[model samples]
Structures are given as C-alpha cells and as structure tokens.
Target: MWALRRAYNPLKRRGFCIGTSRACGAKSELGSCHLDEKASVGEAAQVIADRSLSLKRFYSTTGDSSKFFMGRRSFSSQAGAKSSGEVDDDLEDGFSELESPASAEAILESNAEDENEDELISEPEPSEGDDEDAAVEEPQNELELSDTETDVTEKRSPRKGVPSALFKAIVAAPGLSVHNVLDKWVEEGNDLTRAEISLAMLNLRKRRMYGRALQLSEWLESTKRLDFVERDYASRLDLIAKIRGLHTAEKYIEKIPKSLRGEVIYRTLLANCVSINNVKKAEEVFNKMKDLEFSITPFACNQLLLLYKRFDKKKIADVLLLMEKENVKPSLFTYRILIDTKGQSNDITGMDQIVETMKAEGIEPDINTQAVLAKHYVAGGLKEKAEAVLKEMEGGNLNGNRWACQALLPLYAGLGKADEVGRVWKVCESNPRFDECMAAIEAWGKLNKIEAAEAVFDRMLKTAKKLSSKHYSALLKVYINHKMLVKGKDLVKRMADSGCKIGPLTWDALVKLYVEAGELEKADSILQKAVQQSQMRPMFCSYMVIMDQYTNRGDIHNSEKMFHRMRQAGYMSRLRPFQSLIQAYINAKAPAYGIRERMKADNVFPNKALAGQLAQVDAFRRTAVSDLLD
Candidate 1:
C-alpha cells in the first residue's frame, strides 16, 4: 500500500498518485509525498502525513492508531474571536484547549447500521492526516534501526513462515490481556527469548494490535526476564505513544532511568508529537533534546520536516538551518522532503537541482527519490523527464530491488501508460506483493480497466485468504471510478459479511461510492460513522467529497458542519475546505458573513484563487453606512 504525504490526491494530490489510503492494512510503499488539497500534503500530509517518510498511521479500534500527530496552532485569538450567529459547542471546545493535546479531540460517536456486526479490517485508507512516512519515515526510525534489536524483528517473515508459540498463545487468548496465555505457555516450560519477543512484537504491530503489543511490553518490563537495552526502552515508549495518548508517553519518559533517558527516547516522543502535527509540543520536545545536550539525529530533524511540510512550510528552512548547524548530513529522506517541497511549489528546476546536490554529496537517488522525481516531472508536464526517471528506476537489473515494483506501477499509471503498467505487472506476476497488487489495481483502474482491476482483486482474495478491508478498498476504488454503484455496494457488503475489519480506507471508498452515486445523505452518514470511531481519522478527500457536494448544492449549513468536522478530525486543508464553505454560501445566494474573520481565526490567508472566490462572496454583502461615511 502507498503512503503519500498530504493527499497524493486522486484529482488534486500534486504528484505520486499514491495516498495514505495505500498504507491501509498492507505495507505502505514510499514513492509519493504527503500532499494536500493545494500542495504540501504527503504521507504525512494525511498519514504520509508521516511522509506516509513515506510515514503512515493506521487507525484501529482494536488498539490506538499506529500513527497520529495533530494539534491546532495558537492563533492570535480563536475562542474569544468568534463572529457567529450561533454559539460554539464542545467541538470548538476541543480546539480551544491548545496546551493539552488530549483535550483537543472532538469526535462524535454514533452507532451505525452495523456497529457490531463484524470486526473492522486493517487501518483503512491513509487518513492523509496521519503522516504516512511508514518506510523512510518513522517505522524505520520508530521501530527497526540497524543498531536496535528490532533489526532482527524486520527479518522475520511478515505473514508467512512459522509463528512462534508465544505468538500463537497471544493470538489464541481472548481480549487484549494475554497474561494467562503467557503464563500457560511459560508453565509448560516454554522458554522466551528476546528475539522471540521481538518477533511477536513485530507481528502484533504489523496487525495493528497495539494493545496486545503494549501488554507484551508491560509483561516484559514487569517480569524483567530479559536485559533491557536502550532500544527496548525506545520500543516501549513508541508503543506507549501508539496505544496511549502522546501525553501519556510524555509521562512515561520520567519513569525511564535518567541514564537510559538518552536521545532515542526523547526523539521517539518528538516523533510522536510530529506524527500528530502537535507543532507546539514537537517544538518543545525538540528544544528539550537540545537542552539535554544530546546529539540531534537526522531522524529528529526529519521529524520537524515532516511537521512543517504539512502545517508550516516557512519553518522548514529553519529546520534545515539547524541541521546545518548540527552538521547533520541530509539523508535520502531529507532530500526527498526538500524535493517534494520544491515539486509541490512547481519549481522543477529547484527539485532537479536538489537531486544534483544530493548526487554531488555521493548520495545517489534511491527508488523512492526517483519515484518522487517522476511524479513531479509528470506534474510539471515534463513527460520525457518523467519517463527518463522511470527508466532509471527500472535500471539494468529487474531483480535488484523487489520493492521498486510498488513505485513503478503508480508512476506509470500517473503517466497514463497502460502498457507499461501491464509490463511491470508481468514481472511480478509470479508472486505479486500486497502493495504491488494494490498498485496494479490502482493503475488498471486509472487506465479504466475495471475488469483487470477486479481480476487482481479476485486473485488477491484467493491468494491472501484473510484479506483486510484494504484489499477490498482497491476494488471498491475501481468500482467508484467507473461509477458502478451497485457493484461498489455489493463489494462493501461482502467485505462486512466476510468480517473484514472496516477502516478509514474502506470508509473513504464508501463515502466516494455514495457521493458519486448522488447519495449525499448516505455519504454523510458514513463519514459520521468514521468520526465516531475514536481510533480512525477520515481522509481529507472523504471530507472534501461530501463538502464539495454540499457546496454544489449551495447547502452552506451542512458544508459548514463538514468543514468544522474536518478540522475537528485533524485535517487542515489550507484551501479546499474553505473554498467549499465559501462556494456554498455564494451558490446559495447568501452573504458569507464574517468569512474573512473566520479564516483569520484559523491563521489562513486567502491566495489569488481564494481571493477571487471571496470577491464573489463579498459582492453580495450589504455595505455598512458607517464605512461609507468614513
């Protein structure tokens, strides 16, 4: 699955068509930037919102979402600055408490038609809000580092091969607590090695079963059966942040032995803060690391890049300056972020120049970087440049990198290269990966080959016997694209019936399916259901889909609600949501009263495109007599 920054939007994601949706239950591939409605949304943009590095966060009711870094900026004024006909409610109350990230969550939980019918599947579509950088992003930094014990964790097979007895007992046990299970396993004199525990942790985290993972960590810590290394502490901190709130993780830091409270633990917390887009807290944590006189890692700096890439691009230069001061050589991910920023800005020359600089430093462009280049080149309408980059990705050796197929499929599809898509598919035809299959479905769907896409889905279902909702989402996307509402519904029904875990990606597909089918009410209902699930955050596209539909209908009231809900859901699309809100008011032949003030309250200034929309909205307003006298 893909983990794009921002939106990597279908219609608007700048380049690298992959979005956070790709990071669903499947492995999140790095190729796209986290991008947004306008620009600057990446894997971190939503969950690439992680760099979907490509950082990705998956929401799960089974446990806390794997990633989240979201909080509102402290505007000069917000709560005291309302220009309203109606008063604020608990939703705005959440936004008002800027200091505590915990108080900022304002999800409205409502029971859907099938609330308890079946368990939901893997983390659904990349929320595009989760900071998607799953690969070069945090998971690499957060979990598997070459120096850490978790390196062995990554080597263990993903889903195949024999699972350890500890794993079986943990899974077989009911509820998140597997103490009895662990006790029984130990009672039978089954030995527990750190490697075995590491493998079990890998399996649990992979399945997004963070609660059980936490329990496992707690058991390890409480039992003290094995020696605790810095990595063990770091891993536990990450799981704490992942399962508990960031604040809880912050508190856990004090519990760490002072000597063991090294750079890794603090950076882990910082990464979590950045993951949520909690700018103030991220800054505080980053500053704290400096106060402690710790050597800053590129991982830490990249965390800032991930944060600013979404919420504040202006601050990115500052982070770069610090990296320079600290002599932190830019990693491939650093260059990728820089390149993506330039690409998002449409500065093709700058992007290329960054690559040139990266090469000059002897850091060759990796597969993900090449993918980013192709994406931007296509976005810039430089077809040949894009193709040249794609050729570079293919290189002389097809077997050099198995993962390159994930990048290839989408870049080709973005170029509308149907033949190339199929050719790439042939190479992986012998044993396609989950992510590769996802890319093929997307590529085929983009090329309008619904049947081919469906065939891939069918094959995936048969091969991957217990496919997640993410798998279903691929086909659902195909159906939505072709406007086959009945088929889309049938697929969704089958997913639920099969007891696949419903998630953000699934919700996004459902919302799009209904919206495209002209059922705004149903679409709205589905979004509400997603909002109700505390662990999940809806994709920016999902909210935009319904909001835009309301704007089309000139239903300003519902549009405003969706807009508010979106902000509450941790999405801050700088333009699209506002444009929809204003357009709704304009279309309804009503004055967008105090719209400017509202934008100011959120620290959003109108650009040329927005100014034009505002101009139309302002034209209908009654001029004040006092202003005329003045």
Candidate 2:
C-alpha cells in the first residue's frame, strides 16, 4: 500500500489519473469488487480521493471551498466522462470527503486546471468570416504602419498646407522632372487634387523652381482632367513667360484652340506682353480682343496706358478715350495712372480733375493713391499740396507706417522742410525698419544736413539687430557727399571686419567716393579687387565707372583695357560703355572707326544719339589735328 501511494503521487504530479469505474462499466459496487480487480479499483479510488483533496486545498487557498464543490459536478461532466450520471455522483461523493487539505503541488495543479476551464468557458471562438477579414487587413495595416515610419524617418512631413507625400515626391524629382514623378504617382493609383496641384505650383514658384513648376502646369493642362478656370490659365501663361521667355509664351497662346482663347486668356497674354515690354505683342493681343468684341478689362487698358505713358503722354489721352468708347469703366488703378501721367506732364489741373472724378465715382483714395498724388505734386513743385496729401495719408491710418513715413521724409527733405523731415523721423523712430532708417538717412543727406544724417545712422547702428550692405552704403554715400574720405574708409574697413558682404552698390558708392576725391588709382584698384571677390558677376556700373574716369583723364590705353574687361565680364549691349570707349578712342586720335564695326559685330546698331555723338567726335578730332599741324 505504501509503494502504491508513492507511485500514485508521481502519477498525480504528472496529471495522470486512473480510469473511472464507469469506463470499466462497474458503477455502484466498488467495495464488493472481486479480488482480481481489487488492485485497479483501489488505485482508481485513491487517485479520485487525491484529486478531491487537491481541489479542496485549492479552494481553501483561494477561500472558495463551497463554490469549488458546487462547480465540481459541472467540471466533471464537461471532461467528457463515459457516463455523466455516474461521474456526477462520484465527483460529489469524492468532494464530500475532501475536508482535509492536500499537498501544495496537487493544489497548484488543480487550480491551473480550474483557470484553464474558466478560460475555455469565457472566450468565444472567432468565425470563418472574421478570420478572413483579419487576414485581408493585416497587410494593409502593416503597409500603413510602414508608411508612417518612413514619413517620420525621412522627416518629409507636410508644410505650408502642402501634403507630405506630394511635397516629398516633388522635392525628390530632379530639376524640371516633376512631371515624370507625377505620372508615376498616377500609375500608382494616386491622383493629385486640383488644390494640391495649385499648392505644388505655388511651392515650386516660391522655391524659384520655375521650370519644374511650368512643366507641372503644362502636364496638368495637357491631361484635360482638371476643370481649369480663367485664373488657372492666366497663372499658367504667366509662368510660361517667366520660365520659357515671352516668345515661347506667345507661341503657346497661338497654339491654344481659338474657341478656348477667350477674353481672359488674351488678357493674361496681353498682361505678360506688357510686363516683358513687348509693345507689339501687347498691341496685337489688344486688337484681337477688340475685334472679337470681348469686353476689355481695365487692367489690360491700364497696362497699355502705362506703356504709352512712357514715351507718348499724348497717347495716354487716346487710350482713355478708347476706354470711354468701349464703355470700360476706369478702375482706381486707371485713375492713378492718369494722375501720374498728368503730374509728370505738369498738368496739375488735369490731376485735380481726375481726383474729383474718382471721388465722384465713389472710389476712395487708398494709400497708394495718396502716395502717387504726393509724388506727382512734389515733382510738379506743389509742395503745399504734397504736404496736404501726406497729412491726409497720416489721417488715413498711415500714421507710424514706416513706408509712408519714409516716403514723406524724402519729400519734405526735397521741399527743404527740414523741421517736417525731423517730425516724420520722430514718427518712424519708435520701431524703424532698416529701409525706413536708410530712407531717413538719405533724406537728411539730400537736405545736406550731414550731422542729422550721421545721427540717424548712429541710431540705426545702435538699434538695428541685423544690418545689410544697403544700410552701410547709405551712410557711406553721406560721407562721400561731405568728402569725409577718412570716415568712409574706416566704415569700409569695419564692414570688412564685421564680415558684411560688400554688395555692388556699396562698392560703387566707395569707388565713386574715391573717384570724386581724385584718388583715381586707388578707386580703380578697389573696383578690380571687388570684381574679383564678388560672387555676383561684374555689373556695367563698375566697368562704366573705370571707363568714364579713364576716358575723362584721356588715358585711352586704360580706357580700352576697361572696355575689353567689360566685354570679357559679359556686359555687352550697353551703349554707354561703347560710347565711352569710342569717345576715348577719338579723343586719343586712335582708330575710332573700329568701334562701329565692333558694335555691328555684337549686333548692337548704334542709335541716332550714339551715331550723332560719334560724328561730332570725329569732326572735333579733325579740327584738333588741323590746329596741331598749323
């Protein structure tokens, strides 16, 4: 019996139990068993008794012994017994004798079984449809997670209202090749929305990737998938001209279907022509719009008016009459243009009439209108009226407006109203931008108030967080005008020490100062060094400076050298350089005729002014040679 007990303990630890009496088909008579079956029956009874003792111990450890007995019948029934009725009665009888606690190991085993059974009872099985859905969604969820991770890793999140994916794809495409990437996106079942396309265009434009922007616009237009409105077509045309030049834009307009070339498209093209100063193309488009009886907009007329106002002030009236004939109402811009034209021509009465007409038309004068009125009045010597206009601007919420204050200061300076200039400076001094300070400095410089200019400059230096080359240049100009060479030179040195990049304008100002002070050699040397170190290409102003100084000194050798340098530095097509060189050649009695041939070779035909100047120089040379021989 002791050996059987030892063997039974190991089997119980291993979760092996003896078969039930039901399995042997012998219920209700365990004590009356035959001797041959006695050993097996006794073992079975001992195993059942041990399991019951384990359950009681488990329940005592968990503090639920009564609940354990209550659940015992159900647990036994669920274990797939051979006979439910016999198994229930036997389990109840065994639990009834389980008052004594069992071993810790047996209790733990019974508790584990109870938890597993509870789990089986609590959890429901998933259906086949649910399994299929999970399988389908698994890859999709993984793909989304990977995309999110990639976005985080690449740091290509959306910015400025542009989508992350769209912006990243556009940036990844090579120069002007965004259309190819966009096509790939379409192939991948992703389509760009119109808003996205517009935003991409705007982003590319801001980045100055005009070629790629134009390509994208062209691609979008060619697809015919988008319902492009007038503004879209106009923006596209404007970009086309900006990227591919005006001629290409004209050709593109010609290629557009006649039916689609409505007034809006023609107006856009006309505006482009005006912007590029293609007067012929502008006129052609304007005539076409008129011939088609398309209502010409005031903006288009304003452009034409601006173009004509440059050379023919009389033609401005004709454009106005044309606008009146076409029943095209003049916008505020049109009135401003007319006011500017009349002011330039000294037609003060006409300007006043236009102002009254605008007022009659219920068009209030904006800040721009006030600025134009003041500028023209100043130009026409109406200082009192200009001051009134400026005062009106101040009353109209332009008080402390830096730009308005800047503009007014210069006008007051021009009018010799130093007190008014000081008052305007006070108004802007509270929070002066660099431009405003520079403008104030310039105003004081214009008034020849060197001390006032220096004071403003000093204040700017002390208050400004960041100073650009222009600010330095403005102060340098004041020093130059006053012939303060030592101060100007010291400022230049300080600019260099401070690592401020010397712009062309600053270099020009310094060179002009030196040249004006008769330090020709130093001026030339400084200009040469600046040209070498400057990241910008040498401008015509630099070459013109040296050429003018050398020619005036009759140093024809150096003058010609400077001319060749200008050409080598790619400043062709400027008539002033050629004129300077020709004058220097003629003055030196060298071969002056070769300049004309060179101009022809460069495809720059001498204008009437240049030709007449050349002829006069030739005749003067002849007179000088004759006087020398006599």
Candidate 3:
C-alpha cells in the first residue's frame, strides 16, 4: 500500500494512472516535474489507489514486483508475501475499499487485506535482496508523506500549461485579425514570440485586412523585421501616391527597381501632380529623377516651366538657366508655357525673355500666347507695341484661337480706330467663339457712333443666337444718348419681344425719354406697368419720373397730391417738392396768394441757392414791369 501510494502520487500529477508503482517510476520524473502545489487531495488519493492496484495486480500476477517498484512499501511485503498473486488480489480489494478519494485509508485497507489473505498462491524466485529493498522503500515512502494534503490540482489546473493558456486567449479574440492582435499584444508588452506575431500578421494579411496588414508591416519595419523587397515595394507605392514634384519623383526613381523607372510612370506621376496643383511635390520628384539619369517628358518640362513662370518668373528663369547649364533640352511647349504664364502675370520682362527663348528654340509663339502678351501691352497703354505682336502673328503660322482677335478688337475700339475695329471684327467673324463683335458694338456706342453701333448690332443678330440683355441694353443706351426716342422705344420693345430681362437702367432710360418728349401719358403707363411687374425701380428715379409727367402736363393739383404721397411713402422729401408747390401757387394766383406768394417762393427757391436765385431773378423781372404801381 505504501509502495502503491508512492507510485500513485506521480501518476496523479501527470493526469494519467497507467501502471504499477515500479513500472510507473520509469516515466515518473516526466510526470511529477509538471505538478504544482495546488493539486486536489481527492484526485491525488484516487491516483494513488488506481496506480497502486494496477501495479500490485500486474506484479503479483507476473511474479515480477521489480517492474512495479512496490517492494516493502506495501503491507504485502511487510506481513508476508506468502503468494505474490494472492497478495495482489488482496491489494486489489484493499484498493477498491481505500480508493474512495482518500489515499491513507486505501493504503491501510490494503495492508489489512494482505494480512488476512496470507495463504500462499504463487511463489516468486527471489534473485535479489528482496526483503532489504522492500524495507528501504517503506521508510522512504513514510518520510515522503505529509500530515495535510492540499488540492493544488484544483487551484492550478486552470493555469496548468503556458502554451495552452496563451493559445486560448489568442484564439478567443472575437474574430479579431491575427495581425492586429499580434501588434496589440506586442504593444502591450505581452511577450508573444516574434514567430507567433509574424504568423499572425501573415494570417491577417491573407484575410484581406490590408489596412491592418500595412500597420503590421510598418510595425515590422519599425521593429527591423522588414525585408528588402517589402520595404522597396511599400516605399514605391507610397511615393507614387503622395510625392508630386519632378525633384521628389526623381528621388524615388532610384529606389524603384531599374525595370520600373520608365517614362510612363514618370510622366504619369508628373502630369497628375501638375493637374492637381501640387507643383512643389512635382518639382521634388523631378529633381530626384535627375539623379537617376532618367529623361523627363516635354509636357512635364512645359508644366514645370509654366508653374515657375506663373508663381515666380525670376526664380523660374534662374531654374531654367540652371537646367540649360545641365544640358537639359527645353521643348517648344516649355517656351509656350513660359509665354502664357508671363503674359498672364503681365511680366513684360518675362515676356521679352519668352520671345527671346522662342527665337532661340526656332519655334513661333502660338497666337493665344501672343494675344495675351499683346493684351498686357495694351493694358500698359502701348497700343503700337500690341499691334506689332498682332502683325507678327498674321505673318507667322500662329494657331488662331479667339484670344488675339478678342484682345485686339477691344484695343482698336478703345483707340476709336474704326478701320482696325473692322479688321478685328472680320477676324472675329471667322471664328464662332470670339465675342469681339459684341465688344466692337459696345465700343462704337461708347464713342457715340450710334450708326456704326447699330450696324454691329444687326451683324450680331445674323449669328442666330438669342439676343442677350447686355446687347439690348448697350443699344438701348446708345439710342437714348442720341435722344432718338422712337428708336429707344423700339429697342425696348424689341428687348421685351425677345424675352430679354429689362433692367432698371433700361426702364429709367425709357421713362426719361418719354418725359423729355412731353409724352406724359406714355411715361405714366410705363411706370405703372413697371411697378406692377415688380421691377425694382430706383426710388429717386421713380419720383422724378412721376413729377416730370405731372409737371409737363400742367396738372398742379395732381402733382401736389403725388408729392404728398411720395413724402408719406418716405420716397421724397418735403423740401424737394416745396419749389413745385410755390410754382403752382404763383401760377394759380388765387385769393390770399399775394402775401404768401413771395414767402412760399423764397422757401422753396431761395434767392441764396440756384433755384432760389433763378426764381428771385424771374420775380424781380416780372415785378420790374409794375415799377412804382403801389
């Protein structure tokens, strides 16, 4: 029983009760080394009884207790091993009685059974010091026993193995990507192995958690686990997405595998940057490409040239000089971008340089570029210099966009050069896009050449496009300026018939014309209709029109009533209407009008002011006829 107890303890620690005590001793160290201090006493006792019974039965039946290692540790040896097999049966019965989750009782019961079943069954041929060996084993077993047992297995079983616990926690991460989990664990100082982390990262990447994969890859790089190939590809992808300028793009060119740094990649990235207005980044990429001995596209060079000229012409010139020194060939488009930007910035100095560069390149500056340059010249009041560019464009094979004609037409119109205007108009007529004809018409009107202006208007109608309010307004104002009332009314009617929105200016013009021509009824009808149409009228203009209509018709009472209404509506001041009231009073000459006459006249048309002085002079002249009458 004691021997059985010795073998059973190790078996309980290993989670298996396989054989007799001595037989179990061969694998005892492998099993016992893993046991902790928290194993359960009941489990330990059960293990003890089971191992002891198995050991005793096998040893007694085989008559070889050497393999079992029981020796004197059990009562079979101490009481008498009269028959080893019979003693084994007794030990088995003892084990069944003591194996009720208690080790000590099972040992004692096995001892009593051995003593009771002392009859010999089978005799073993002793080839060794069997009695002494048994005695030594018993004392050792007794010394190893403790007074109190602990259920260490119960307390420690939950946390038994490190590998199993770690795996459980990792797998139970609620479908979390393994790469993310590894990164979190590493970040948290969880001591997860690198191989484990790498495996997790790979798993996550395979699941298409690309963002998470990139994070882990970055972490791997930060941690210095990143290999050459991954680092190269990742850097290239990132650079293509973010870096813009030629200088920056050039810098990345070297990092790219030799096979990938072709014109397509280079030009594509450069063009994208230019379009998106990322010029600085594009410049950096371009510079980087230079170090790699790669050639840039003409378009890229042109875009860069334009960017430089637009933002800082002087700086760009310096860059161009530097590039020239480096033997970089500038394309014609490069000169064109230069011309365009210089013209846009009104940089005359840059424009001269652009012309010089175009000459050096043996390339004719396109008409659009030349037109912009000419327009700048015109703005500076240098018309002759602008004409020179236009003249040069005529002789050269300039691609004729509407730009030059548009610029030149206005310039000629401003100078009142009708011949030049006609010439520009002809060019404008050739191209459908140019609005030069409209501009020429406006200029003629501005110069007070209403006849020529009307001629231009008739030409615009031939274009078959609907007449715009702007065109109508221009012509309307021209007619009004000439006091051509009939023509002005016709223009307004034409504007309305064409569904053109009449503005306040147009309405004011028409109203003033009618009132000036003494067409009071016509002016009044127009005003009422305008007001009903909800057309916003200038308050002063409306009041003036109404007053003009009443005054022209000699309707003093109606005029006075309108005056009061205007004042009440906050549109007219009492002071403004005082003169008209005084005039009306003087004209009527009714009862009590004599004493109030001079006073009323002075109040509105004071002799100290223009209206007053005029009224006082008229009064003096009229009264002068009645000299000495009083």
Candidate 4:
C-alpha cells in the first residue's frame, strides 16, 4: 500500500485524489486489490462539487466574480470530470451568488459545512501567484464593467428631439456610404415619419447643407415614404436653384412629371426669376401659367408688373389691363403698386383716385400707401402735405414702427426742417433698427450736426452686438463729410482688424475721404487695392470717384485708363459711367465725340438729357477748331 501511494503521489499534485478507504484496502497490494471505476467516478464528482462551492464563497467574499467563474471553467476543462451542462449550471450558480444578498460571513458559514464532508477532496486555496495575477487584472475588469454600465445608462436616458443613437448613426453614415446607413437603419426595424424627414431636411437646409438636404428628400421620395405637397415641392425646387444654378434648376424642373407642375411650383420659380432679374424666364413662366389655365393670383401678376416697372412703364399698364381682362382680382399689393406708379409719374389726382377706389373696395390704406403718398407729395414740392401725412401716422399706433419713422426722418432732412428731424429722431431713437439708425445718421449728416450723428453712431455701437459693412460705411461717410480724416483712417484700420469684410461701400467712402483731403494718388492707390482684395466686383461708384478726380485734374490718360477698366470689368450696363467719361472728356478739352460712338457700340442709347449734353459738347468742339483755323 505504501508502494502504491508512492507511485501515485505525482497525480495527487495535479488534483487527482483516490478515496482513502478504497486506496488503503483494495489497492493495498497493486495486483491483489482491483480498483473500482465507479469509486473513481464518485471521487471525481466530489472534487467538482467542492470546486463549485469554493467559487461561490470566493464570489460572495470579494463581490468580484469574474476571476472565480474563469478559474472554475478552467478547472473543469482540465480535469475532464464535468460535462458542459454541468459547467453552465455552475456558472449560473456563480451568478446567482453575486445577485444574492448573502453576506460574506453567511456564505463562509455555509461553505464550512461542506468543508468537513469534502475533506478527502482537498479543496484548493488561492496561491500567492494567483493573488498577484488577480491584482493585475482587477483594473481591466473594473474598466470593462464601467464601460458596460455606461452603455446601459445611455440606453435608459432620453435624448433630445432627435434620438441620440439615430443621430449618431446618421452623422457617421457619411463616413461610410449614405445608402449603407439608410439600409442599416431600415434593417434595425426603425421607421422615420414624413414629418421627421421634413424636419431633418429643413435642419440641413438651415445649415446650408443643401446637397445633404436634397439627398434626404430624394431618399424620402424614392422610398415612397413622404407624400410631398405643392409647398414641399416648391421648397425643394427653390433649394435646388439656390444650391445648383438656374440652368440646373431648369433641368430639374424638366425632369418633374407634368402632373406635378402646378401653379404653386410655377409661382415659386417665377419669384426666383424675378429676384435674379431673369426677365425672359419670368415671361416664359407667366405665359406658361396663362396657357395652363392656372388661376393666376394677383401675386403672380404683380411679379410681372414689378419686372416691367423697372424697364418699361408702358408694360406695367398693359399688365394691369390684362389682369382686368383675365378677371384676376387685384390684391392690396396691386393697388399699392398703382399708387406708386402714379406718384412716380407726378400724377397726384391719379393717386388720390386710387386711394378712394381702395377704400371703396374695403381695403384701408396701410403704411405703404401712406409712404407712397408722402414720397410723391415731397417729390411734387408739397412738403406741407407730406408733413400732414406723417402727423396723421403719428396719431395711430406709430410706436415701435421704426420704418415709418425712418421714412419721415429723410423727408424732414430733405426739407431742411432741422427741428422736425430732431423730433422724428426722438420718436425713433428707442428700439431703433439698423436701417432706422442709418437713416437717423444720414439726417443728422444732412443737418450738419456732426456731433449728433456721432452720438447716434456711438449709441448704435453700444446697443447693437454687431454692425455690418454697410453700417461702417455709413459712419465712414459721416466722418468724411465732417472732414474727420484721422477718425476715418482709424475706422478703416478698426474695420480691417475686426475682420469685417470690406465692401464696395466701405471702399467708396474711404476713397472719397482721400479725395476730399486732396490726396488723389492715395485715393487711386486705395481704390486699386480694394478692387484687388474684394471678392465682390467693385461698385460703379468706386470707379466714378477716381475717374472724376483724374478728369477734374485734366489727367485724361488716367481717366481713360480707369474708364476702360470699368468696361472690362463688365460694369457699364448703366449710363452713369458713360456720362461721367463724356463729361470728363469735355472738361479736359479732349475731342469727346468718340464717347457717343462707344456708347452706341455698347447698345446704350443716350436719353434726352444725355443727348442734349452730347450735342452741346460737339458744338463747342467745332467752334473751338473753327476759331483756331481763323
């Protein structure tokens, strides 16, 4: 028996134990005692049961369970004494111990009972090496546990209007293919409502991510998820034109089914055309609407009316007559346009009749109507009537109406009523908008009250969080008008430092300052630098300033150079630049007849006033040459 114990001692170190009774009696003599396989199986079962209890105690004691389960699984596999089902059951018991409220002492007491029964099993205790391994692995286990807890918490918490998980998926979708994201979202058993898609599209549009918005709209349409209405289609079309160009918008419109081309879509396109001054396209759309028998709203008619008002006054009258023939009721905007047209033509009786007609139609005159009357009254030299109109507006709810106050300030300033300008300023100073502040500054500038203008400007800077280039330009003009050269230079420097994009107006004001201060070369240099640096095309005023300066100084070469640059820059659409050059040539005593030829080549015919000036210049040139010959 001692010899048998000595030979099997090596297997004992590997956790293989023989039952004491069986080993001493049956296996006392190696050949005489036969070992029972059933007894060995029973002994292995006892070893596994002892291991399971030790794991439970370890888990309960430390309240850290990963090590115990891992150790048990490894022990079972190495021993080959437990089935997978038994291992799984043991794992479940480990988990149950963790969830249970049994204290360390209670678990230890339960483990103590089994300790005596499994004495022959020799339950394993953790070694020094195992403790060190566990110490090293503790932090990693803690980190994984924390990460899992965070994921659970995030899933439990509510998100904003957008689901955080879905938003993250969408944002990350672009990194992958957008289609892949869409497919994954659909596969996740999630569905987006039409309103949700529309809101997402609008959010993208506001961020100027027009391409993304277009893509989302297309996706929604392709999936047959959204039944887009007329307004939605119109909005999409407008967005297409804004992001892509007019030509692309035209292509997109062509692709639209004829069934979807309704009045609203045409009206939206017509409005865009009007904004870009696309007269031919606007006419085509108007005619298309007429041919389609789309009920032409007054808004549509007014678009054409306003377009014609810019170039052909006769066409405006024709539009109104067509509207009457079509039986399209004129809106309040239509009546306002008529009043303004009559006012511009200086037909006061015509304006009054329109007002009466409006009132008879139950349309009370709005501020716009009163503004037109006041403007025409001022134009016709009826300042008293303009003042009465303003006083009447004041009697109504005029407070917080900064626009009316702005219009009145300029009229009072133009009439040289300094006291009235001050009164208007007092009424408008509270809650003044940017345009109102600008109007007040201009009025004070006209009244030659530089201090008052500066005060308004100072107040504007203090109250407003930001001022645009236009605001700075207006202030620069005030500084130049008052001959504050140092202050104007400082303003320019401050504008540059503050990173406000230097606009044409700012450049024009700065150049005017230099010209007023008798620095012609500096003015020209500044103008050139501004033209070079500005992303926008230089304004006609920028060119006119330097051209006038050079021509006045009899520098005809420089004047002609500047004029050619203006033409090359495609800014000669208006007649003002041509008039400036012709006047310059006449003043310089240079033969100015060629100016009329150039104007003709540019297809710019002289108006009555320009023709008279050209004729006078021609006569003066011939007379001077005839006298020299004599």
> lDDT for each of the candidates?
0.61, 0.54, 0.43, 0.53
Candidate 3 lDDT over residue span 1-630, tens digit each: 222122212344433333422343333333321222133254334323322322221112122223322332221111111111111211110011101111112112112111111110111111111121111111111110001122223223443222232343445454336456656766777655544444443333222223343444455555565453422343333333332323554555566676655544554455434433343455545544554445543444554553443222322432343344344555544454455444544456656665765665576655545655665676667778877876775664324544445445555555567786776666665553314555665556656778887877787676545655444555665565567888888888887796655654455567666766767678767766765685343233444556645654556776776666555534322233444444444454422234235444432212122233234435345465577684
How would you encode candidate 4's per-residue C-alpha lDDT over 206-297 as one tens digit per residue?
22344555566666667776786655676677666655645777787777777877876777677655544455567667666656667766
Tell me model 1's lDDT, rounded to 2 decimals. 0.61
Q: lDDT of candidate 2?
A: 0.54
- Maximum-TM-score candidate: 1
Q: Name the candidate, 1 or 4, with the larger lDDT value.
A: 1
Ranking by TM-score: 1, 4, 2, 3
Error of 4 at 350 (Å): 4.5
Work out the TM-score per prediction.
0.72, 0.51, 0.29, 0.56
| 1 versus 2: better lDDT goes to | 1
**Candidate 2: RMSD to truth:** 45.6
lDDT of 4: 0.53
- The best candidate by lDDT is 1
Q: CA lDDT of 537 in candidate 3?
A: 36
Instruction: Report RMSD (Å) for each prediction in the order shown.
Output: 13.5, 45.6, 50.2, 42.2
User: Candidate 2 on 470-511: residue-level lDDT in tens?
Assistant: 467778877877888998999888877866656555666677
lDDT of 1 by residue, 1-630 (tens): 011222222225333333322332133223222334333343223322212221222111222322233222211111121121112221110111111110101100000001111111222222111222121111212333224344534454464234567776787778655877787777898889876887777656555556777788888888787687776787788878776668889888888888888887887787667545566677668667766667777777776775565444544543554455456776666777777767766778667767777777788877666777787888788999999988888886656766678778867887899998988899888898776788788788878888898898888887865666556766786788788999998988898897676665677778888988888999999889777864666666677778888888999889999989988876562545677798888889887878888887775655444666787788544567746876
Query: To one decimal, what is the Cα RMSD in angstroms of model 1 from the true structure?
Result: 13.5
